[model samples]
Structures are given as structure tokens and as C-alpha cells.
Target: MSAPKIKCPTCTRVIEYSDQYPHRPFCSERCKLIDLGEWASEKHKIEGNSIYDDLLSDDLEQPD
Candidate 1:
């Protein structure tokens, strides 16, 4: 059987999904780093409410 094909998340390049690809979803280290940079800079975020908001509200409601 042949390796499954997938597009690189960063560059949109078609790549074979196999053990040879250290960066599975990305084509290269550069592309992987770019994605990481985006996340570090808050360019990526999970949708929906976070528990941190409730925690902060509770903290604010209490005396400091």
C-alpha cells in the first residue's frame, strides 16, 4: 500500500503521510515553526468559553 497524501497546514503543499516526515502535518521545519509562531502570538485560539474567565471573575469578586 502507498502512503496517504495530505496537504501541509502551513504551505498547503501536498505531502505523503509517512514516518519519514518528522513534521507530519507540515512540509518542513520552517513551516512547522511558522505555525508555532502563530500560536505563540495568539494567532490561533480554541473556540468557546474558557474556565480562566470564571476563575478571574471569582477572584475579582473576593477581597484582595
Candidate 2:
């Protein structure tokens, strides 16, 4: 089992799997940093929701 070379999510730099390299999937630290920045800044938005809860609301009111 071994990691494969893939483009950096931020800079699209090809990264190979090896011991000589520390940050895999990224060409250099800068690329990794950029990716981190994207994550921190929330440039990507994933869509999903919990399947357990289907109810919109459960509010009950009584006249006083």
C-alpha cells in the first residue's frame, strides 16, 4: 500500500509519494499553505444534511 501522486488542491501541483517529501499531494509548503488558506477562508462549500431529523419545527403555542 502506497500513496499516489496527485495535483495539489490549491495550486494544482503534482505531488509524488516518497520519504524525501514531507507534504504529500502538494509540490511545496506554499501550495499546502494555500490549500490551508482556502479551507480557513471557506472558499469551498459542501452540501449535506442529517438524515435522521426530517421535521422542520416543533413549536406549540397556547393563548394566555
Candidate-wise lDDT, in order: 0.91, 0.69
RMSD of 2: 6.0
Worst 10 residues of 2 by lDDT: 51-60
Model 2, residue 31: distance off in Å is 0.6
Runs in model 2 deviating more than 4 A are 1-4, 50-64
lDDT of 1 at 63: 58
Best of the candidates, lDDT: 1
TM-score of 2: 0.57
| Model 2 lDDT, residue 49, Cα | 53
lDDT of 2 by residue, 1-64 (tens): 6767777666776766776567776777887888788878988656665344434333435457
Please list the Cα RMSD from the true structure of every candidate, rounded to 1 decimal place: 3.4, 6.0
